[model samples]
Target: MDALLERIQSPAHLRQLSPASLQGLAVELRERLIETVSKTGGHFSSNLGTVELTIALHYVFNTPEDRLIWDVGHQTYAHKILTGRNLRMGSLRQQGGLSGFPRREESIYDAFGTAHSSTSISAALGMAVAAQLTGSQRKAVAIIGDGALTAGMAYEALNNAGASNCDVLVILNDNDMSISPPVGALNQYLAELMSGRFYAQAKKIGERVLRNAPPLFALARHIEQQTQTLIQSNTIFEKLGFTYTGPIDGHDVDGLVATLEKISKAKGPQFLHVVTRKGKGYEKAEIDPVTYHGPPKFNPSLGVVGAASSKVTFTHVFGQWLCDMAAKDPRVIGITPAMREGSGMVEFSQRFPNRYHDVGIAEQHAVTFAAGLACEGLKPVVAIYSTFLQRAYDQLIHDVALQNLPVVFALDRAGLVGADGPTHAGMFDIAFTRCIPNMSVACPADENECRQLLSSAYAQDHPVTVRYPRGAGAGVVVEKSLTPLPLGQAKIVREGEGLAILCFGPLLYEALKVAEPLNATVVNMRWAKPLDLKILQEIAQSHDRLVTLEDGTRMGGAGSAVLEALQDMGISRQVLIMGFEDQFTEHGDPGLLMQQYGLTASGIQQRIEALWPVAQVTSALRRVV
Candidate 1:
């Protein structure tokens, strides 16, 4: 069975296998995926679900020639394995290793690089149109999850694709899950489509009538088509001009292959709805798909064990703050674009279900919706990932900031996100948000500061975003009280001579580590937008040189704010701006990435030493004395 998998190098080889052999191959592929992901700690349940679908698609389609775009690309582990990357699975999501999501740079089979959701249909449609224009026989396919269908972008693409009359296949992989269990009317519509009695009966009647009638094969097919059209004429996909087919079993390899083969030969836009269990083959994943969705490296037999950590994550701090603040204020409402568990709002949703809204992967709508809530005198706290917030920039500027709505944005994952890579990194939020006219950006230093900043952001009248990193900060005790910190004030953590380090966000600790050795002063610049000019000027007057440290991009970031302020104040001091360079960060361990990018303590020290040597610092200290 293992040899069967090893022999197949690409989809070309996969196509060579007989239809009966594919079932065995799918099993082997699932086993290989589970084994690899168990050790690598990448996406789990989603990958398991797509094993058969991936195999069947690759087997049926002339891939590389025919484009296949996967929406939210996390379920491409099996796709990667089949696309000649099986041997490299050990290094999945590691530094310079295979990406957790589909990446065009990694393989030719990857039609489009996608970590974000609801993008596949648009990309696939573009490819399909291009192929049609070039007079190419190549087909385009977009395998989008049911969860992705919630976003308005998917519908926009569908509307266009249907009208274009191009030969494109859009397979809706309905697993009834997308990170958190999918919500909204779309999910309900899909469920209704799957279980509707009339449609099911009509399909059954067509199949039964067609059975044992080889002589009337053409007649039987026509009857089935007519029966399906009568029943499914009102379907959303059909209405959009797509020839909608199936609520078929996604795990049935032969069935999938047969359906795909038929669709491949047909013309015009096609929509195939395939129902799949999120964790089909693996029992542990199948039982609890959510926990296994993106688990850490775990023992396959024992499964993902919940080990309590002493350090409190910034997300937990925000969750706790949201709950506490909601308890105090009746106007408080929590909003997330389908990230309940990811944003640590699970407790808040449970406690205040009415006030909590998971808008389902629709970032633009989430922002505008929060703005509407704010207009109606409700304090809408949009708990969103910094990366996801980019999707709603127009909404943020027009709906929220332009109106100066008091919507508190709790931006989780505000820096290099490690394994998820550049596509998911929240490095540009500070830069982007600061430039927006009426928006305020807060960068918390630690766990306690994160809670305080959330409170502070909530208390503000205008739109404010409190940005924090992915995991736990420096284990500072988070205070229980909903005390708002003084807005836009910089806190002096340590006072020294010669040089001063203006640190933004959690990088304050890294600056502190190098402060003592370099005889430097450390100032925690809490707010990126409303810079504390008073404290900045004071620090500049006292120190010989200044350094601005942030976890975001160097261009137009928190450091840039400091520089612009200094220039306006006419303070001519030699300053070093430190942050992420103009490049997409790679997938790896966060600490290692920090070191590589010279964001760690030792790395900071080295960068500082290179600019102003130990001798220069000593001389400056002597002059100060």
Candidate 2:
């Protein structure tokens, strides 16, 4: 039985398996996924949920030719396994290995790359339209979750797709989740759509009754529509011109295979609503899906035993600051785009439920909504990931920054976020946010500074973004009080002659380590936007050479800002900027990525040695002595 799964090198091989063998293959696949993912620590519960759906899709469709687009891409582990990526599943999310999400370059089977949510419908529609233009018989299937369907983009795609007469099949994989639990009116609507017995009964009756009579087919459809309108309300998909079908059991492989087979041959934009449970096979995951959503490495037999560490993460610091901020300020409100837990807003959400807004998977809406709240004299704190914030760049600029709304963006994962890869990396935040006119970007050196900077940002009149890296900082003691740091000030951490190392964010630690050997002065430049010109002038006057260090991209980043400031002041000794290269950082251990990108102490030391040789420095010291 296990050998059957081994034979499935590709979807072509997958189609060869009998319907009876599929269930057995599915069992084997599930076991393999659990075994591999448990050690590799890839997306857990979502992948577990979609095992059957993935199998059914490949089994039914001529994938690679028939484009299959996965919305959000967390559930595509099974799809990857079926499409000749099973062998490399162990290296999932690792550097120089398979991406956690779908990548077009990675394989021909991956029709479109997807890391973000609500994009499958649009991508699938485009593929279908492209096929139509080329006169190809290929189909485009979009497997979107109810969670992704919450976004307005999905609806917009649905509207356009319905109007265009393209053959795009949208399979709603309703597991009632995104990263966190599904929320808002859309989830409720989906629940209603699933539970409505009248619609289901009427649909069955109409199909049976209409098949016998050719002339009364239109009348039968009319009757079905009337029944739906009266009982279940006119489905949004139906109104948008999709032939809707089923709250079908997604776990039932034979049923899914049969349904998908029929739907493949169907005309126009079709929507098949399939109900699924997150972590269907694994009991531990089923009991608590959120915890198992993206768990670290753990033994499957023993259950989730999280790595024991007393170290406080930057996320925890943000969560503490959020709770404290909400407690003191009566007008303070918290917001996240379906990232309550991820953004460290779970406690804030629990404590101040009224003030907390979880605008599900709608980053654009979340930003503008925060602006609206700010307009109403509410100090809205938008706790969001740096990667996710890219989606709301227009809203941040147009609605918030342009208006100079008093909003605080507590941007978590503001640098090379390990494991999630380049798509989820926060490398662009410093470059992106600093360029905006009314935006003030703060880079904290450590956890304590992170808290202080957050408080400082909240007090500001204009839109302020406080960006912090993922995971634990440099073991700095976090202060309990929310006293703000001096705005646009650089703190000289250590005074030394010859060279200056100007650091931004938590990369200050690495700079300090590199500076120790070089006897370079280390300055923690707190704010990225409002360059500390006074401190820069003093450092420029004192040091023969200056090195700017940051964890973001070198181009248009904090280092670039420093260079521009130095140019404006007409004080250029010799400047060397160090940060991420002009390329997407691959998925790997954060420390390894830092080393590879020349952000680590050893890497920085080598770069500095290249600029001013250690031998030359020693000779200069000897001559001076």
Candidate 3:
């Protein structure tokens, strides 16, 4: 670490560094980020892209004092490095270490905890309002990506803030790619505007000239504004009543700092559109950023460690299932809220381009869009992450569940996501989705089970959600076929004696291990919603102790479903619900996180040993039998 890096032990120390030194710090931070992330193989391009912008923000503004809200927080590694986490960079995403995203508890500099896309503007605006109401002199700055900016909530926030005259800064980091290649004409135009430097320089000169001179300058500025208003097509931000500034170069640290310093004191709802490269520094990442966006572990010196298609992921299973299902069913249509690649709908998009809908960072809109499509008799499969599905709760409840629409929600990354932290973890999907009236929830044990459950969900007309975890399964050889499993049925994977370990999703392995010492029976009750009564009754009658396990919260999860079932039946079954408690799972390796949360095979084994006495032997079995 250099002097600049050494000085930044915390955000308070950042104020000590000069602008030029801060710029140097940004370079070193980027080098550090690249070095660390390249080896760790996590969020390389996003962090590299935001280096200068991160430095400029800290240099121009008072962070921690001034609330800095980062939307879709993949771009926050630079901010983290600058905000006294420089030494802790190596501890990122590790167990008992730092997180990859902005956590409110992690640092005072991160004003809001963010993981989902398209939320910063609204959150920042709320903070701005709160600050004003509380008579605090803190400024609210929402650093959002171009992709996140496309969401309707950002526009809504812009509209409200513009009208309220809130002194909030909306920095649009346009990278031409948001995880994957950006779609729509607005993205293309922004790319064209940012690639060339002349436009920004000329605009800066015009602005400076307008600021210095008097009546004539004001008149010219007015005319210039009028001309821009007339000539330029109404971009999304401008339409929402924001004072649009730039398609500026985000990489130019000095230029950005100066512009921000100028914008910092400016009036209400300012939108600074800064264009950045996705993988700014590293050559390999710059060339192919999509691959490097959220790469797995690799050697920093060797670029990427293995070929992109070295092995199959659970996403691969979903992708194959999607294509196969589409081929089989004419009504099948695929939908993604700007997660075409992540959700494994790329082939579906290609094969059925007309049937495919990439709704661009709008989860609510996507859910409602699918609801509409379902009403028209199309089997709309909205493949989204469990974390992102939280954004469309009302739509999922009101639009689909009430009406009983046939929307198949393929929920990817349904459990504890590694590295991305609490924001990215899909732990709450079960708790939230279970309460809804007509929605059926499905959890698959492995890749094969995931495809089958997806197929089953597709066949249903009552709005089903099939959730699966990230990465590869237990290397189970999945059938190159789409076979719909029996809905609301639990499959008995094992039949033992002393204990019964009932589980949903990927935690079935953990439950199996916990059951091993107790000589327990293991049941993979694939569906959470229906709460397979047959299996529940059988286990209740036969087993002494029934332990429920899931990768979600214990409150309203798979275990909760079993308890609800027992309540309805009026039978007191010894159901010990074991899952992640009300607490949030932090950023770490999924295995380590699972272990920490007692969702690991070993962790479950220990917990079961302690809590295994929930069951009681019958008096008749002891005496008469």
Candidate 4:
């Protein structure tokens, strides 16, 4: 049979399909998603859960004109497939291929670019307001997951959205899970609301009797109101000024289509709660969604196979260090913003459940919460991604750094995170963190250094952050002992003449590669802040040319800090800075990105040869011959 999905080039075509045919299309879509993701290795469980919802949205709503915003767009693979990109499913997340998230440039249907969570409501509200002002009949809808609602921004938008007169439909796709199991009051409230028999009975009984008798319906409504008064007051959404609907089965395509058909015609702010199961169709994924949340390339029939590696990742080093530190120091505590597994804190969390805190998707709260713990004489270690840390910049500066609290931030995924792309990339941390007062930042070059730096940060009385890259470091033997490195120091890795490369973080390994070919000096500048002045000064004085290298952004990065130090010492040495360029980096293989950005050994060597005219001429002449 020719699949109905192939005919759905756009939402316009989707509107042509019969209601029963939409169900078959959904089956084909789910199978397509499972097969495509198994080969491509993209987001799995979330996409599976949103299959019917995505189909229903495009089928009922006039997309491209009527803006449909998806929060934390990992589940938009089905949306992409339905909206004319079905054939290109094979190239998902590849270089120059379709992005994992919704991009405004990619299609007219993608009204807004969204990779971060909790912004869909605000973006949709703005679009709704714009439509109202322009007198357009076009509607705006925000499809947000229950997990994304954990952040305060979602509520702030909800508070404003509920009060406004704009036309917008806020569909709450409740799967009872975010990336990690959702925590806090919101999850509890939704759980209570979903399971409460009083509300369920009232809804069922009130609607049945009202339809049966239109004349006595007004009196029946009064009785239903009396029954409601006996229970709790109106729902949280009702207070926020949104007309509430559902707790509907999201997998039921016909029900979803019918409900959305009505909501599309309604005016003002409307809220619809749809219940879904993560990894809905796939059996293995249904049993263990977390394992299937994001799996590597695998055979779908056999399920995801585990691949073993001997290399110890930097995240693993921090996780082990956290356990060791907690064991030695009774005051040691660990915290993650709903990323216990991703941050490599699963074992620590299992071992020390009391000492571990997972503050669900709230980075700002996590930072301030850590600050509160530090005030009471307990040492708190915040394990967060570098990109996510941007969300808590104000909290870090105001609550932690301002008070000089002894909070150790073990920043995992500190550089170019691979397939997840720019949205997940940890490019701006060095620039942002280094500027904060009373904040000390260290970048480790290897697994051994990562462990030592973590120990060093924990030893400090003030705020200290140990920033390391995503995966395993340069295959170095990490010692079991917990020893602190001297703060604000640099290690002279190699010695040569004429040229010097002062490298920061894991890029030191690449620097060593380039330095060996040129006989250039290499200094592993471990600390980004409190720049290793003594060693930098000596290198500047001796070497005819100096180069500063970092894996972070070129603008106001670690290399820029080195430039400021040289200027302070009144040195007029010729210097070249190398790092990520001004534009946002695209998603691809991490090694390919590094090579393209000129961070690899050969790339760095070529850049150095460009600076040294004699070497450049010799290289060019040799190539010609």
Candidate 5:
């Protein structure tokens, strides 16, 4: 056991320590975080960044009573360590263990359950409102990153908070890097040179003078306002109704603690702009936060490393296709909402610097920005996570789909993303994206298909989305040559006598397993939107039973599509739908989750076994009748 880990018994223990002792504790905590997280493989860089800030927040505020909401929640590891979760840190992100994100169920200190970005303000505002209504003397503090503030939702919350005049403290953790370092800092910096004590005192003196005097004081106040604006211009945040505070060094614990303590007593909505490095203490992560954002378990000394096999992932397939497509067509433009490394755009970005756009952590902006780019002759490809794309649904519909703009949306993590849990799962893209008019959705069965579909989406001038799951491909050799296949068509993987399994995306692999034993015909329904009716009708006429399977939500998924197709055709074939139930999946290993959901090869085979016996029994009953 680490001696440092033992010292962090509680936040109270943290409060008692002097500045020098706390600094030593921070180093110890950083070492413990590195050792455990390197083995457990949770979020690294952001947690490393927020160590001192977390310590200061606890030291300054009365937590459990005072609400503190972390924007992304991954950065709350240090907060968790301080708030009586130090022992459970080793089991971070594991099943039945500490969550990677903040969980209200786990501790009272975790005021809100969070994983998605830019939601802390809204949640914190709600907490403030609740406290006000209940007559609870609890202060609500929302710690948000400048990157998350780029999202329109954050501004919406700020507008509401300012109008309501709720006593909420919003700390903007600005590092000029909100996941990616390319997003430079914005806003004023008077608080940088002047101490918080001086600023507070000056504010009091100005208010007193303004109350007593008339003409000369009014003139002085106007001059002072102008001077302050020139020195520390009222940025967009202040205009929205927040009392803008800082661009302070977030790493300075004593400075942060003192500032927060002073501001905690203030009576209105306050915004503290504290800037810190992303991968603060660890040099490797500090230098390359984007790459080290969510690295797998590894030896910390060797630095973060990728898989040795160089197994071609679906993401890699997209990357190659993007670079190749951009090379061939100058009009093709690539855009990502600050996911350059994860979405596999590094090579393409390097190759076509002018054509590629990293639109910070603003999904809404990314969509509209791409839509504007599309108004010209440029074909914009917005690569984003399936879960994150949920944020841009309105933008996609209003800006792209309604206008019928040529925006190729590459939806990454288009299935059950393991370990990240319900908030991170790509379960609803099929249901949600399908609802938009003039929108085309495609899912690939393998790596080769993923490349070809992307090529197809780019070739089309209308709004098209191609979604692919995370992790490596099905080991299918992808071709360098790009070709657009006929739209609304499904391919048959095998032929059978009785049962037909219609599988979409990743479920194709498992469906094949069920098919191999039972000799069932399997159709890889590549397109999720335009249901492949020709094959569906053919199979309905031939097979007595049809099984539809997918990795997404069962509601309005590929199974539902097949059922709708058969219903529209008036061909009442006995169809069995299989996929995720209408429930949020918990965090676990991908394989474990798959098995739990009965979406695995053996699990599918067991279903086939039960159905095979039923088929025989039904045939015999027909003879008896």
Candidate 6:
């Protein structure tokens, strides 16, 4: 017989299978998921954990017509497979391949696109309200993890969703982990809710009621309502206007299907708590789900092995610098919004347990919390991703920058992050941070500069952001001493004639390569906020043409800052600004993406030659002469 997974074309096919056959389909789905991810490398444990739930959801729900939104969307591999995308699983996160997250453009089954966490409930509520307005019977369900529930937006949506009494269903997939182990009062409340005597008593009461009652619809309703009332007094969801159900076993496809069927017919907002284990079927992943959360391609039999790399990543440099800085200054505190592992703060967290704060997935609270610490004479370093920091823009401006608080923001993954796509890219950090008053932005060129600039930012009295790319840079040897670089200063690395390239961040290496062949002067503009006017004037006067390069967006970016400064300085040199255009970049290899965007060395050379053909010809003639 053909495999159950091979025969299924869509949810329609999935729904056709017998209740007994559904478990076999789940087994096949898990096998397929493990096989594909072992080769392609993606959200492993989360996707593995969601297999049974995905099966149950698709089996029970009408799908496509009935909207399904996956929060953080990393665990949607099974969802994709069931929705007629099994063959394309091989291309997951590859160049021009399937997105790791749910994208509306990818399929109709992906009702709402999500990469960032805690957005599903809000989006689902909006869709549910829309359905109400249109007089449709289609249901909307938002499946969010417990880690995502840490965000305030989820509660804000919950408050509105409850009061509105819409047909939105919020399914809490309580896996007891987000990216990091789940934290906060909510997590504690959930643990208590699951283990408390009330839940146990309610179960006994319901079971006893079911045994004695007549096999009628009214009796079933009476038992359900009675058991719910027992549990409702203890639940926060019930108070928020939701009919709370379960702390049920998510892996039991039969139970999930039965429960979902019952909930589907219920009126008003619904909150179902389903407990699942991360990396449920896989033994190795079950032991250490975090390491397997997003591992590289590896053999499933051997599991993931730590492969040593010669190159030091910027994340490592930051982590090392953080530990060193903390040792020297007792006032130094490290904080991350549930990205302690991602931001390279494991060592710091281990060494300074008291000072280390993982503020869950709340970006807004993290920034304000850092600001509050700074007010009390403690220096707080908020190590966060460039994209994630966008969530706390208002907190940054109002709490940190407005007060001129000395909060050092270590903006990791500051530029085009490979594979994660535009949602995770740090393209706007340069433009966004520079515009804010009292917020200085530093663009480090290499690993050594990253450490030095971090020190410099730390030394400042006001809020400063030191932006660095995702991976390793030019492999510059980092200095052991804690030394601060001069703030708002540019360094001229090379001197040549005809053209000068002002490079920012890690793109300095690419600029150097372009400059070598053209004999063009290269200046590493360290700061994007306080433009190096003295160096800009000299570069402008000495060179016939100027070019600005960065890894961020062209509009209002570091390149734009250069142009604005030149305009103010009354310099008439023909300047060409080069950076990412005003478009969201796609998920692909970083090197390939850079080449496609004309940000690589050869690509930069081609653009320069094309833009200034006459200048190139004149330079060639001069060299010949």
TM-score of 4: 0.97
Model 2 Cα lDDT, one tens digit per residue, 13-61: 9999899988888888899889988988978998889989999999999
Each model's lDDT comes to: 0.91, 0.89, 0.82, 0.89, 0.83, 0.91
lDDT of 1 by residue, 172-225 (tens): 999999899889999988887887656664766767776778668678777766
Query: Which should have the higher TM-score, number 3 or number 4?
Result: 4
List the candidates' TM-scores in order.
0.96, 0.96, 0.92, 0.97, 0.91, 0.95
Q: List the residue pairs that clash in candidate 6.
A: none
Better of 4 and 5 by TM-score: 4
lDDT of 2: 0.89
Better of 3 and 4 by lDDT: 4
- Candidate 5 backbone collisions, by pair: none
**Model 1 / residue 252 / CA error / Å:** 0.7
User: How does model 4 fare in lDDT?
Assistant: 0.89
Model 2 quality (TM-score): 0.96
Give the TM-score (vs. native) of candidate 3: 0.92
The window of 10 residues in a row where model 5 has the poorest summed lDDT is 616-625
Clashing residue pairs found in predicted model 4 = none
lDDT score for candidate 3 against the true structure: 0.82
Q: For model 3, what is the error of residue 459's alpha carbon versus the real structure, in angstroms, after optimal superposition?
A: 1.6
lDDT of 5: 0.83
Candidate 6 regions with alpha-carbon error over 4 angstroms: 197-233, 614-625
Error of 1 at 487 (Å): 0.6
Residues forming the 10-long window of minimal summed lDDT in candidate 6:
616-625
Model 4 poorest ten-residue lDDT run: 616-625
* lDDT (Cα, tens digit) per residue for candidate 3, span 142-174: 998848866888777777877877788899888
lDDT of 2 at 199: 60
